[model samples]
Every structure is written in C-alpha cells, then in structure tokens.
Target: MMRDQAESLRNMVKKNRSVDFQVISITSGKGGVGKTSFTVNLAYILQKMGKNVLILDADLALANVDIVLNEKPKYNLLHLLTGEKNINEIIWSSKYGIKFIPAASGFEELANLPKEQQMFILNSLQDIYYSFDIMLIDTSAGISESVINFCLAADKTVVVTTPDPTAVADSYAICRIISNYNTGNMELGLVVNMTDNEKEAERIYNATNNVIRKFSGKTIKYYGCIRKDEKLSKSIRERFVLTSRYPNSKYSQDLEIVAKAILEGNLPEKKENFWRRILNNWINLKFD
Candidate 1:
C-alpha cells in the first residue's frame, strides 16, 4: 500500500517539474540564536518578491512559528501525522501572504516519531509539492537525529549562528555532522546573525568555515549576515514581522540581500522524484 502511494507521489512531482519549488532547511546549533526569526522574516521577504512560499516549522517540540507570526493555526503536523487531518487542513496562511506548517508543542512522540510515520508525513506532502516556489523548513537546534535527517533531506541547508563563541562552536558541530552525509544535490550554506557590522560577520563566518574545512573538509557557502538592530526587538514585541513593520530597517534590508542571493543561485534540476529521495534517506538515516 505504501509503495503504491509513493509511486503516485513520484508521478505528481514529475508532472509538476515546471513549478521548480526549492526546499531549504534553516537550522542552528543552539537555541535563542534568532534562527526562527530569520526563517519567518526571509519567508516574508520572498513572498513580497512575488514568490510563493511555505514554511514548515519542523521544530516538533516547542514549535512556535505560528506564535511568531501572530496567527493561530487550526491544525498542525501532529494532526496530519496521526491521520486526524490532511496536509491542507494543517497548513495556515499568514497575513504576510506566506503559508506555514505548524508543529505540535511539547509532543514527545512527535519529536521522535517512528520511521513509518515519518514517511507517511513526507508522502502526504506530495499533494502540494508544486503549490509554491519555495519550501523553507525551520528545523530545531542541536545535532540530533531529527535535525540531521531534516537537513539532509532538503535541497539546501542554511546553518544560522551568531558572533558568540559558543554559538559558533555549536554551529561548526552541526555543520560537521551534516558534512558526513554525502549530500549529492544539497547545498550547504551559513548565515551569521547578530553581528555588529559586516566585518564582524565576516570574522564569524571565516572562523566557522575554517573549523569545518580543517576538521571535516567540507566547504560552506556564505549567505551574508544580519547586523544587530534595536528596531528588531521592537518589532518582535509588537508581534509584527520586521520586514513588514520596518521595510527600510537595516535588519530587513540585510535579509532582502540574502533572499536575493538565494534567488540568484542555480538550483539543480530534479533528476529523481522528490518524495522518493526523501523517503529513501529517511529509511536509511543514521544517528551515531
């Protein structure tokens, strides 16, 4: 039964090849590093650029994308996984014109869902695979099995970090772990957040890049940085996206540049079926 469903999903992908949706996993090594904020703001900017976007709040436990967006979702991924609802029912459209898949907060079983259930959720996404131009996955922090699997399964992974030494160290650890997997078609990149200036961002990026290259022999593409801005905190308190609240703010402009870089990059054509590749990786995932 599962095999038949998987086959059907593959055909759906092949038929919608022209849509060319890009799936990007945004993650970090430690919590409270502005990872989710970056994800939300980026989606907002992309939508403003006339690109259809969807955010999958992959942080199973403590999921808060909906909270950040100031919108309440009727359903979440847990409902979809448990067969209580379909994918469309769980996806909520934000006022910013972008859509998102909310995850259940404090759900332990969801954090470590069984392999079969994981595939079931991935297979369910086929119905809307071509519905958007970009799918941004906001994965949880740390180098857990779930984090690594989510990063590996995406078309690209953006590792977010700050100028703090501990954050840089943790970012390197996650990058090293992801480097172990032969990411055939996946692009690995880094985003330096909370920098005082461009120079500080470069220093942090170079430091993290040096460690990864020296220890893991993996190259990480630089995706620019976001400087420290006081207005960012104010926007957060107001529960409004920084881009929408202060489009000319430095933080918002910086994210606009990053989004432009991502849009300019050449994503490889889909050589294999999307869901098939994701399920194959999920089934053979290793955590050691």
Candidate 2:
C-alpha cells in the first residue's frame, strides 16, 4: 500500500512539473510578415502569465526587436563577444518583465559566425540560459545559413506568414529547407498574421501544410491567427508593444490565443542548453 501511494505521488509530481527550459525561434519565410512584432508581444504575454522570457534579436543584419520595443540598444552580442561588454550590460529589460538581447549589425552579422565566435557567445550567455523559462530567437526571414540553423536548433519553431501567395510560398520554402536539413519530427507551428478573418488564416495554414506534405512528411501546427489591425501598426509607430499598450486590441487578443496554444502544446524533447544546441547546429550549417 505504501509503495502504491509513493508511486501515485511521483506521478503527480511529474504531471505538475514542466521542462526547465524552452527555446522557440520566431522565424518567417520572407520579410514583412510581422515576425518581430509577434516575438516582442508574445514575450510580453508570456511574462504576464508568470514566465520569465528572453528575446534574442537573431535577425543578424537587421535587428529590430529593440526598435519594436522602442529601445535603442547600445550594446549587442558583438560587444559581448569582443569582451567590450558583459552579459548583464547588454541585456535590455522591458517594463513588462521580459528581457531583450539585440543582435549585432553590419560586419558582425555577416555570413555564418566563426566557430570560435560561436563558442564565445555560448560561454557568454551560459548564465542567461538558466535564468529564463523561455528564449525567443527572432531569426531573420528566409533560409539563410544562420537562420536555418537557428530554426532547427530551437525546441520549437513558429513560422509566421500572411495570406498572400508569395508569403505562403516563402513560408513553404523555409519549412522545406528545415525538413531537408533534419528529417526528424520537428516541433514546428504556423502563425498566420495580417489576415482579415479566421477562415482565411486557417486556409493559408492548410494550404501551406498541403504543399509541405509533397516534399516532406513534416506538418506544422496551426497555433492561431492574428487579424489585420491598425492598432498594432500605430503601437509600433509609438515604439510601444501592442499587447502592453492596448491589451484589448484584436491583434493582441489573437496573439494571446497563439501564446496559449504554444504553451499548451507538447514541448519538443531537448536534453542540452540552448546555446550548446545552437553551437552544434552552427557547426553543421554550411555557408555559401
């Protein structure tokens, strides 16, 4: 009887506990799909839900997470890599409780970073890996070497898209590239942004997955959809997060639904720290 009681207690504990860490990459097939906006606002929503969140502006050349948050970062990963700044010095904490790490621009984002440089980043961010419940990597759009590596290395990857044909094609392109690189069952999701209605959004997702089925067996989860809302654009112009500034906006509410879907989904199996997994993926990415 005691053994059965102890077994039941263990089951209860297992059910209550979540993964210690989760790394999700917010990527797009092409630019102008509102990927960064989703990243920042989603981080805010996650923070409000009592989870510590970190946003890594991994767009390489064009880092915009800071701009979306209305923050001009004085230091980025390049500074940390050069020993010009410490880990704590470069992180920009928002008033909403999430942390932001902007990427280095210009020469620093060129091509794939050197292995040594990659290791420098891994070492520098070691502390941060333990401090946050989740790290949202806002990767640059397209299937560039670095971007592909970022998407694949993540525990979960959400491909943001619009209902436009080109956007859908581009979204499929990235999903195809990802599947080509890793033939495993990756935890991939789709977020349709800038849609006029839910049906339109679901149609885009279904069509994209239908094509993805041709070249690869992998399918993407339909997290949720965001309707086209002028408030989001206005909030960005004011350098404020839409969800934080106007929580009741349709865009914000849609994003909250997406965030809840993500949190409710099955987390991908991961056994190592995010940076370490990134380092390994970096080694595998072949630059042109």
Question: Which residue pairs in candidate 1 collide?
Answer: none
lDDT of 2 by residue, 85-106 (tens): 8888999876666688878667
Each prediction's Cα lDDT score?
Answer: 0.82, 0.78
TM-score of 2: 0.87
Q: In candidate 2, which residue ranges exceed 4 Å CA deviation?
A: 1-19, 106-112, 270-273, 283-288
Task: Please report how far candidate 2 places residue 67 from its true position, in Å.
Answer: 0.7
Full-model lDDT, candidate 2:
0.78
TM-score for each candidate, following the candidate numbering:
0.91, 0.87
- The number of residue pairs in model 2 that clash at the backbone is 0
> Which pairs clash inside model 2?
none
